[model samples]
Target: MSQATPTSQSQNVQTVTIEREMNEYGALTVHVDGQNATRHIVEYASDELKTILRQLPSGSSVPLTIEPIGTRGNAWRATSLTQ
Candidate 1:
């Protein structure tokens, strides 16, 4: 038997940019751009994005996901990039 995969328009897109900032709670403000990026917020932040910042090249685009953690905040989690 053969299996099929679910279709999702929000998959496989790569990051165009990522930035980190801080708020009163010491949260990370991450700005990421990707395919159909306009569908998302202007910019968001997360602890995960803070983890991967130095590892990534300045101005290098990476693959990530927009994760929502309720009251905590939203974050950009890097999984992969164009390379």
Candidate 2:
């Protein structure tokens, strides 16, 4: 019998500045080094992240990491939200 080998893949994490909420759907518009990036604010977002967004006004700049999830990698999740 042949043993199956496991393959490792590295995920790319992107840091961007929060621009504003895209809509009521929990999506946030952000800028990655001045380029607009649309990131979805997952329902399971950390309390810290929600607090930060609540306190900050629209257009206020804040650092956050956006990453892809699931097998299709079509969806994104926000993380590491910081000032």
Candidate 3:
């Protein structure tokens, strides 16, 4: 398993959406603008993040601080999230 580390500084991403269901690996997937531009996934989401997601409705646009997870820069993770 790849250890998710913040490769770079936090990026201000807009129009972020967190999937309601977890993937096969039990990780929460996130998308920007309904597309897979920056494949951000939360393998272990914080309690705060979970609370935020549960309160918001589906397809709601939220602010997120995304960072590249691995050295490959192909995968990302949500370091911070806001409404």
Instruction: For residue 51, give model 2's deviation from the true position in Å.
Output: 2.7
lDDT for 68 in candidate 3 is 62
Error of 2 at 40 (Å): 3.4
**Model 2 ranges off by over 4 Å:** 1-15, 34-36, 71-74
**How far off is residue 26 in model 3, in Å?**
5.0
User: Candidate 3: lDDT over CA atoms?
Assistant: 0.57
Which ten contiguous residues of candidate 1 have the minimum total lDDT?
35-44
TM-score of candidate 1 to 2 decimals: 0.34
Residue-by-residue lDDT tens digits, candidate 2, 1-83 = 55333222323355555567545565665666555556555532486665566566666666665556554534655556644
Order of candidate numbers by TM-score, starting with the best = 3, 2, 1
Give the winner by lDDT: 1 or 2. Answer: 2
Q: How does each model score on TM-score?
A: 0.34, 0.52, 0.53
Better of 1 and 2 by TM-score: 2
Name the candidate, 2 or 3, with the larger TM-score value: 3
Name the candidate that leads on lDDT.
Answer: 3
Clashing pairs in 3: none
